[model samples]
Target chain A: MNLEDYKGIWIFVEYTEDKISELTFELLGIGRRLADKLKVELSSVILGHNIKCDLNLLFHYGSDKIYKLDNKHLEVYRTIPFTDALEYLVNKYRPEVLILPATSIGKDLAPRLACRLETGLSADCTELDIGPDGNLIQKKPSYSENDYITILTPNHRPQMITIRSKIFTPQTPDPNRTGKIIEEHLELNESENWTKILEIIEEDQEDANIQEAEIIVSVGRGIKKPENLGLIKKLSSCINASIGASRSIVDLGWISHYHQVGLTGKTVKPKIYIACGISGAVHHIIGMKSSDFIIAINKDPEAPIFQVADIGIIGDLFEIIPILIDKLTIK
Target chain B: MKIIVCIKQVPETNNIDFNPSDLTINRSHVNGIINPFDLNAIEEAVRIKEKFDDVTISVISMGPPSFEKTLKEALTYGLDSAYLISDKLFAGSDTFSTAYILAESIKAIGDFDLILCGKHAIDGETGQVGSEIAENLKIPQATNVKKIEFHENKKIIKVESDTENGYRVLEVKLPALITVNKEINVPRIPSFKDARKALKIPIIKWDLGKLKNIDKTKIGLTGSPTKVVNIEKFQKKKDTKFISGTPNEIVNELYQILKDKHVV
Candidate 1:
């Protein structure tokens, strides 16, 4: 009933060791656009211990206000403490919209916060907009298949949106932009923290992180038998490209699902994506469509993949792949 | 120790095709299977049951009546009991409502020391329901669990879960919820004999009428605060050009295109 109390838009800034997460800037970029359209101020929340970062750093990213919860217990990324800090800020400020990343910490915290506040949180969203009736329109893959679904939370306060990484481009930092930073007060105690972080060890996740690679040479079922995959790998290595596979290739047991690139697999936005023996199914196309340059080498002239490729080559990959390995020898 | 692992039936994606007209998956042509991560959760619970002398593992799923088959399959994996929560009211429920009903059903099952789930359902992919259930039950939660250990006579549990950067080891008190990732363990396949014997046991079924003290406004699509407003089919770019030639000529052309794109 007190809808007027809820105003500005807020971004949950996930930071560590004085470096802000890239997703924060991206949210700020999109949040600024949304906030401007609604004629509301864009604010950010920072929770950390002994935090010494320059508050003005956020002003460059178009943030109009910053809410700080600084305490010794707020240093590391603990679930309870972080969630409590965020919950406290939202309940008091009553922001109309809140955005967070779909990272591990965000994934753990957002759902709990939404439940605690009795609001709705949309996860892994790729697009966000304010609807005509002022509701938040959340766009994301339903996670079942390749199609995008638009979701709206009309009744929840601080309508929450969790966005996946690399979904949006961040804006350039402007030195002239200025804003107000308001430090908040909070009562912190160790007893309230049930989960204890004894150690933090980063896992070596080099396998699927290839989605971040510059050049990727991916193979599909068109590569045929599992043994013939050697030709695809040889070409990838010749160009110093990462190896990727279509869902069918993985399903056929030719490669691990970790190398799968499709709606069910990882969404890759590489610089150069070479699809070898790929028929360009929609499932495979969505994953690599963002590539700056795509070249499809499928024997079928009518393969759907050529539609998205910059240059479509209709020929036998069995012969062309070896020549590709020899012609552009990166070594 | 009494543990509950929540799983779901997901449409096997490989055989399904995207309906270009409405941008929805054509599920009529595919079959459903246990969510991949949930199988990891079931295996972890089974491993725990094997380690302890007095442990009962129960598997729960919220789906249509056909999901009774999925619960039976869970029993073949060594779980002691199975529960299926199906209701006309639950047909269009979102994540929050789904978590609420599951939490209430877990409460009805009585005291439990552990609750486990897949980090995210393959279909919804929100990765939120498990934590939402924890919130509804007012318990601690650890997500993306890759490794877990019991300590202090099962008074507390320590776990190392995967994160975007790597992994973090955290210790939480018992009677908590955790969502496991795929790296936990390789799930065991259901044996034909175990599968057959498992189906002989009657599955516990509960509908909205059976669940007590639940707010009706929060159970189905009406209780769900979110709605899908639009579904648009993906349209590929049409400006691409085709090239056909001898292997040498095609390679030369591609090499030139890559150079022009500065794709090297």
Candidate 2:
């Protein structure tokens, strides 16, 4: 229980197809800052059936050391083997803090590790800082995304947190930076994993979700019918923007689940978000409220969406959208 | 086969607002609803009971005594029984501590075949409890279970769970846990007839005294590794500049603003 035993900040360097994920680099950016604030070393952990991943990129990002478990058993992201290997590494080289990207792997593994270590872990933290006593100060939106709650793992050694993607920008790669790479022998065998990845079936989904779109034209119940979506599409095509919808529209089967934008849906941080006819429930607002420029057009002046919009036009979206389309086309 | 479904009661999200004075959630201002996702888990349990022979569904929740309201609501879905693990000491427990108490409850129940939970609570959205509970019980766990099928006298359960990368069809042994989302099945509304009958079934309430060998340090807010340090409203430019006039004038105004921002 002595905090002195855990002395370094560690980032779980996740990989996809032999390349490091952006979240790993983002954590490195924040992780390095935390390490500096705590006056401790920064390290990265990678456990994969890897033969081809490069380690230099990790150091270039921010890692002072890399603790890796490279073995055939570690190739797949089965819960048991990874936990066994990670638990061993964490116990051997105890960390003051452990940060992981809130990807599926991290979501599955972080809790198991924390449970084994009997430590506290914050999930989907958007903001993190070193507190006055060297504890982790983590902030995340509460269940409804209505308010942000700050969390601290004050008493636990190796305080854990899983941060959401895009919360932090990554540090630039410094090719000159060098770090130690410590490899561990995988003690876990295949027999330890009770569950198996029967088969991975990746569907070819070409649609651009609101999360990655630069410009999103999102709609809500104000659209009279599914056909009225054409009016919004007209504006999107004119301005080269993607289509997004509120949960009500998606639940009506007017659009697929992938295009829904809300707390129950995808979180989007687009450059320009156009809310047409959307009443702006707290759920829908939280998803796209982070957009750079928001323009809300609705007949109801008091619609909540207008509260977050930079420019609020109180009018019928059916009327406003067509006129805007004409203007954009003419320009 | 005995199935245990984990459910949680959370604030109705639609009306959630924060206190400006202290950025923390003003829960008193918001009404409570059984987490929408947990309803799906309860439905899956009911559906499994209907399909299989000699199957009983038991629902469990950890919260204040009032949480029993949600448990009664679940019983209306035709579940066999319910248990409320409510205790003042359990307050402020994080996902880990919460999972530990549930795991202990499962062990105490003994002779259970399966545990099911919603993928995540909408309020917390952590999605960490099922896996952590499985780890504590040393049972296999699967998340995002889209479709699940039991085979060979319920020795193994086949599941198709969605991951960020793709869907993986996994087969895990019995005495395992699976967390499901909306993709699994449509939750049914409780029938009035069943609701009446459900009200008659006395709910077994377990407090800290009921759970034996419970470590005091690992049960409540004290045992929880995570602590809430602060709460703040996530910032957004809330005030807006309304563009008034005719539809034509509004469009013209929007175009000029877009032009100034170079959004065009």
Candidate 3:
């Protein structure tokens, strides 16, 4: 656990369909800050078969160094081979801190990597900082869900923290900035690996990535009946925005779990997020608090949602939605 | 196939009370229930058992002896067996230490094909223990699973991982570990027949000496790298600004406030 043994900050650069995940860039922004604070270099570990586009983008996002392990076996993400590759890098060059996006791949891969390294990892962290004593402090909401608990990895060689996407804004890429590239060879036998990616069933592209949507129209328990959701859908279509909901709505089977936005749900950072009849429980707030604009429409002005909302409306959503829809149609 | 589901007894959030003086939670007044996320994992495990008649499902938990009550509740779901790992020596364990003890206990129990866990515990919310356990056992693992399919002949397991944007379908060998999200499945309530059977069954409890290759340093607070240096009761701000207007007027006024806040 010697501090000098670990050299720099590293971000796991994840990609899909030969495209860089937005979370990769977001991690770079956060990694840059942590690296600057700790006075260490910021690096990225890119694993893919052919990631020419992704490699170029990593330099743009401020990676001081890139560790590329390009191979046919690394084409799709699986547990064993991917973990083996990452474990190799972490062992070879110990990092002072590692930041990963709390996405499905990141969540699955981060914990496995931490365990292999026999180190400490903090997951779904909303805030990360360096303590005066030079320890990595990861802060997240605790039991009550109202307050945050700041955690520090005191004895671990490389403190790992996974940040949920959309919690931090991505910084602008500087084309002028450049860094060195370090290539790592994959040594594991593909046949011996435990997991294999069978097939990639591509979902419809028309479906919006709720976490990345600029405008979102979210429904809650106040919708009353499932049929009334058409109004929300109509509004969403009119505005060309995606539809989201609180956990209550999802739990009630009013919508699929994919539409859920909250603590246990997807954390959306939409430019404009409208809450229709949502009471805004703390569990729900953790997901959408990062949204750039929040408009809460609830019958109860006392609802917790109003506290964090930029606009708080006190009236029935049924009455207001129609009028707003009519106004928008005319405009 | 023998599936081992690791569950925890957590304080129901609704019943939790805050201690202002020390900023600690008062657990005495709160009722404990199986962690909600673990319930989903247990349900999935039961579904797998039903698919394979020879499958044996065991529910395991590590906590105070009274936490064995949760094992009885698990029996109501038709679990084949239950085990409780309780010892005062394992108190105040963080994820690192907790995983070590659980892994050791799992090895002692033997005959395990798959291990299931909730993606994260509500009490700790760290989501590290399941991975830690898999690491300790040297098994492949996956988290945030939305769907699971088993290939009995090939001994391969396919899991759909719920990513932030979409899903990643992964096929892994058996004798693996998985942590499921609540979205995976709906848990069923126990029937009267199963409930009666559960009441008759006794949980097998174990102490530190019962586990093999026990690492004392990695079983408690000593093995933990992170500590809760401080915990303060959270207090919400008491400021409330009330505005009076007709529906249309209020909408207009709210719109103005939203504009000022750049929320529109």
Candidate 4:
């Protein structure tokens, strides 16, 4: 475990619907900054089956080089195969820091990879930087959104961290930029995988995911009855917004957990977030506070949600929402 | 069927304040509750035990001795036995060290058919311990699991893991680990009789010495590679513009604001 053996920063490149994931692009933005600070190269590692994309986008996004491994076993997102391939790469070409998105695929792969490498992996990091002593400084929100703790893997090589998407803005891609592509070969035995994928069910597009929604109309216990969701629907329809919910309503079975916006649910950052009848608990606030513009309608003037809202209206949502919908519908 | 469920007791509320001087959570007035997701894991394990024959469920946790109270409460959910690994030396362990302690304890317990854990603890929210344990034990793992079904031979498990867009069904071999998500099932409330019975059940306590061949450096803070350098209060802009008046007036003002922002 010689720290000197690790020299560069690497970001795990992920794909969604054949294109590089937005999160992976975002990682390159931060990875570029960190690599520049350490005076080391920033590389993107892609492991997939028959990846057809030129992967010039990695360089355009900010990668100095690309390490790719293409094999039939690496096609689908399986924990064992992905972990084995990554373990091979990290050992063959040691990286000082490895970053990944805290998305479903990344969360599943990073921890297992960390265990195999016996290194430290910080989870859902909100901030990453180079410390004074040249260690990767990982900052993440603790139990409470109000408190953030900075962590450092002082004794580990190839420090690892998983960051949630939308924390950093992706840089504009420069098509002129190109990087050295290093295609790596790994012999993976299919028999090593103890788990087999049976099927992948893509959700029907009946509703946009709140995380991807441009505008969100989120509700809470203040909405009262289940039937009152009609009011929220009316408002959302008028504004072309996706419906989001606080954990309380989601837990009460008023809405699907997919629409939940909070600590246990989804972290959403939309263009405009309208919180109706929500008290704005720290849990709920952490999810939507990052939205570009936040408007809160709550009867309680002291509701914590108001603390983050740009525009706060202390009124009954039942009365306020209908009129607001009418005004928007009229437009 | 032998099932091991890993659970954690966390602060009841996420509104914990930070002690800037020592960079620590101000836990002076906070009470602990079973991590909410772990309750789902406990309920799922209990449901499986009821659905099958010869299914013995054992719960494990690592924390302060105060966690024993939580383990006892888990038994009220119809789990068969409980184990708590607590030691002063294990304090301040990060996820890696914490996983090592739990994995070592699981190894000492010998053979088991399945391991279940909450997707992540609410307090730390690392979501790593479950997967790390599987790696340490060199077993297959399915995380963010929403549903699970057993094969007729009872040697393989098919699980639906939540993905970003939808779900993926995976078939994992026996002796695998699965971390349950809150969407899996609703936890059932125990009756007074169950509580009384749970009180009568004895809990097996383990210290650092209880884990055989355990590396002392990897079991606690000293073994931990990561260190908390600082704790700071999150700052956000508090310049909220309050709109007052009748419902109509407020809506008109809000609509005007929205129109100004070109949102309408």
Positional deviation of B232 in candidate 2, in angstroms? 3.2
In candidate 1, chain A reaches a TM of 0.84
DockQ of 1: 0.63
Best by TM-score: 4
Q: Candidate 4's error at A273, in angstroms?
A: 1.4
lDDT of 2 by residue, B1-264 (tens): 899999999888655554444334456767777888888888999888888889999999989999888888889998888999988999989898999998988787777888999989887788888988998898888887888998876888889988664688888888888989888889998888888889898898998798986777897878888888676667544667889998888888888987887768
Residue B3's lDDT in candidate 4: 96
Candidate 1's C-alpha runs over 4 A off are: A191-193, A204-212, A220-265, A277-286, A299-307, B18-24, B236-239
Between candidates 2 and 3, name the one with more favorable DockQ: 2
Residues forming the 10-long window of minimal summed lDDT in candidate 1 chain A: A202-211
In Å, residue A324's CA in model 1 sits off its true spot by 2.2
Model 3 TM: 0.92
lDDT of 4 by residue, B1-264 (tens): 999999999887745544433334467888888998899999999888989999999999999998998999899988888999999988998888888899999999889999999999987788999999999999999999999999999999999999888999999998999999988998999978878888888999999677757788786777887888898877545788999999989988998887887778
After the best TM-score superposition of candidate 2, give how far the Cα of residue B32 lies from its true spot, in angstroms.
2.6
- Ten contiguous residues minimizing lDDT sum, candidate 2 chain B: B16-25
lDDT string for model 2 (A1-331, tens) is 7888889999998886778887799999999999999989999999887546788999999999999888787777777788888888889999989998887778878888899888888887877888788888888777564678988888887899997666677888899999999988866655523687788887654464456678888888999799888898888888778889998888788977778886667777788999988988777876777788898888886677877888888889877778888889888
**Clash count, one per candidate:** 1, 2, 0, 1
Better of 2 and 3 by lDDT: 2
For candidate 1, write residues B32-69 as lDDT tens digits: 88888899999999899888889998899998999988
DockQ, every prediction: 0.63, 0.62, 0.43, 0.62
lDDT of 4 by residue, A1-331 (tens): 8789899999999996578888899999999999999999999999988897669899999999999998888888999989999999999999999998999989999999998898999998888889888999999887553678899999898899998887887888999999899999988887634589999999874685787788999999999999999999988988889999998898899988889897887888998999998887667777788899999989987677887889999889988898888888877
Report the C-alpha displacement of residue A6, candidate 1, in angstroms.
1.4
Stronger candidate by lDDT (1 vs 4) = 4
| CAPRI-style grade of the A/B interface in model 4 | medium
- Lowest-scoring 10 consecutive residues by lDDT in candidate 4 chain A? A140-149
